[model samples]
Target: MQEVPVQRQHVGGSVCLLRLLGGDGHRTVRGFLGGSLLMNCKYWHGDEMKPTFWCKLGTDSDCAADIVITSKNQSMVWRERFSIRDNHAGKLFMVTTEGLAEGDMGTYLCKVQRSTTQREESYGVKVMVSTNTSAAMR
Candidate 1:
């Protein structure tokens, strides 16, 4: 995979803007085991009408196994332990994963599906699950 430049701007709390030049970039996120994690991914303004998806990166480097998919008509979509919300006005999307486990430590993808002729725009995210010793004690 080719490396792309990334610009991060804090957007309050756990939210941030991940700006990528060619609409693709890599980022790292951490979450406590048995807790949750939130990831925000930015996209071009005009692309907001398109569908957005979140999934663990598969061997083919595509969203072959989608965790959650948000429709243009619906601002949010939830499935099992995963939820995705699209903020069309903000030109960004937020994905939340709850009840994290050790197996969740891997690469994920934030993708936008475009016209059939166009390739999907995506942002790569690496998730790391850390154990909370204090919580484990209790």
Candidate 2:
């Protein structure tokens, strides 16, 4: 059975409060080892442009340590396996990974960096990778 996406918000104990918005904010996304995974995140903060980052959930709660790819305007990380696209009119960002592998299996967070604030407002997505997709279907 397919998993259902959830929506929720999280507040840090400290001054910074991060809210998860859009997509499967509470469900884990499943994919085959060799397949690709796609994620979409949205944020709106006036006309000023902000940078969007995708990171893996590491041993520590710090998201910065697991940095993967970042996108801003028409520029972003230039990597063969990673790509990002933006829906300019809708303020939606799409992150796609090619040749998914065991190492890629993990929880990921997407956030837009607002220059006005020091804290990062993000959306969390869990990813589960399987080596045998055919067997799992049975």
Candidate 3:
């Protein structure tokens, strides 16, 4: 969850919604996302951990989503194991099984909804399970 500079609006109407509030859009993934281009929406159950995203919020399938993976590496903690709540299978948002180890890196969040009162986009990720440990942590 990085590359945030949004200013949403959807209030004062019968449940209009879109928000990200302040700058909670975290970031800590691999790095170099300066141009924005990462999205999978779904299809990584080979173990679970091909997490990559920068933006892919308009393919039209109704596009409803919810995903969260977190970590800031504070001695390691198992936060946000998995997510997929209001997903209409917009391709895929997240999955779990055994990918993204290293105590599961940190800093990740994806939230998009067409309901839930109002929210259209959200992302802030930072998971690095690649130290060349033979490779395989998504």
**Model 2 per-residue lDDT at 2:** 23
Q: Give the range where candidate 2 is weakest over 10 consecutive residues by summed lDDT.
A: 9-18
Candidate 3 achieves a global lDDT of: 0.31
Q: Show how many residue pairs clash in every candidate, following the order shown.
A: 0, 0, 16
RMSD of 1: 5.8
Clashing pairs in 2: none
- Residue-level lDDT tens digits of model 2 in 112-138: 776675666677776667776643122
Q: In model 1, where is the ten-residue run with the lowest total lDDT?
A: 9-18
What is the per-residue lDDT of model 3 for residues 94-119, given as tens digits with 9 covering 90 to 100?
A: 32312334544544445433345645
Span of ten consecutive residues with least summed lDDT in model 3: 13-22
For candidate 1, write residues 94-134 as lDDT tens digits: 88887888998889888888999997888888877768533
Arrange candidates by TM-score, descending: 1, 2, 3
Off by over 4 Å in 2: 1-20, 23-25, 45-48, 64-77, 116-118, 134-138
| Best model per lDDT | 1
Whole-model lDDT values for every prediction: 0.72, 0.58, 0.31
